[model samples]
Target: MKRRILVVDDQRHMANVIKFNLEKEDFEVILSHDGGDAIKKAFDCCPDLILLDIILPKKDGFQVLKEIRKKTITPVIIVTSQEDEEHKVQGLDLGADDYITKPFGIKELVARVKANLRRLEYLNLPKKSNIIASEDLVIDISKYEVKKDGQVINLTLREFELLKFLALRSEKVFSREQLLEEVWGYEHYGDIRTVDVTIRRLREKVENQSGKYKHILTKRGVGYYFRRI
Candidate 1:
């Protein structure tokens, strides 16, 4: 089946451009001009991925993202004109899969879409070991699920992959650049800051409220690693 994508943008031309480009790639594209409709379409269409614009009519992207996250783990890539680091961090913190600034090349946008979808595809495959357990944390590779203390933990595809890769090689440190290549499937030239953002988000999700991370540990100058139970 051709993958479906929801493109949410108030700008008609922008939305049309994305839709046209994505259709060329053989993806089924759905468009929503407002946040209200975007959230509705997200649940109704059950799209494989979403291209979400930060500024939209009715509710705005962040609100729509929060609503969508409350129900589904569908991958979301924030497309915005904003270039501020704070805005990017906010979107990532709210569970956005990726962030792309406006005036970006169409090919770059398409590449990011493919990359996020590719990760999702990789996550859906069957695995040999299937499950990795360490104390209260459990990672089910087959089901693509993670649980801490028997309670299901909601993780984005990238977050799950990062944790899985490190936990499988517990106590082994990986630099940000290495992690970008290994976990993100990006080259060494990829942004290392992305690794930091992802790590912060992962820590927020998996670590307890007290801020003690038992699973993912920071190596300070180096990078990060999963603790050996």
Candidate 2:
């Protein structure tokens, strides 16, 4: 099956150029010129990945990304001209998997896209017979799924990876920075409230069980750890 890529940029030529290259790689490319259009395209295409630009005529990439994250877990990479630390940080915090500064080499862009998509794929792949169960919770790595009291929990792509990593290394306190690299599979620094954000979200799905919450605790002044409930 061909991977579909949606390129959301206001620059027609730039969108076309990127589309051309992606199509060359046998990817089906979709194009949208503004944030509003980007959102619609995202829903319609259900792309394997999205290459979104920051500046747009309507809502802008940040707004577009917020909407995308709310509705879909599809991986999105912000393709932008902004190189400032704040800009990069903002995008990542907004749920973008990665960012590429403008004037980027096409080869590098493709490589980044491949890497992220691969990460996404690995994040979703179902685990086989790999099972780790306790009295209260069950983590099946082969199934790439989790259950607490026999109820399946819904976790975002990144959230699942974070939980999996912490569970595998239970009792170890991983700093925010270390978790960022291990779970994100990248070290694009600017700011990393993302690690904090994802952890909180994971708690909601995994640890914040209505009546019985399991491990996955926060170490004040340190980071996070997983232990028996």
Using TM-score as the measure, the top candidate is 1
What is residue 86's positional error in candidate 1, in angstroms?
A: 0.5
List, residue by residue over 134-156, the lDDT tens digit for candidate 1: 88888888888899899998897
Q: Model 2, range 1-229, lDDT digits (tens) per residue?
A: 9989999999999999999999898899999998998999999879999999999998999999999998887888888897677777677667777778889888878877887777877866665687766566788887777897799876656676778888888889998988877776656542367677666666676665573446778889999998854
Indicate the residue-level lDDT of 21 in model 1.
Answer: 91
Best by lDDT: 1
Off by over 4 Å in 2: 129-155, 173-182, 186-225
Compared with the true structure, the alpha-carbon lDDT of candidate 1 equals: 0.87
Residue 128 displacement in candidate 2 (angstroms): 3.3
Query: Local distance difference test, per candidate?
Result: 0.87, 0.80
TM-scores for every candidate against the unseen true structure: 0.93, 0.73
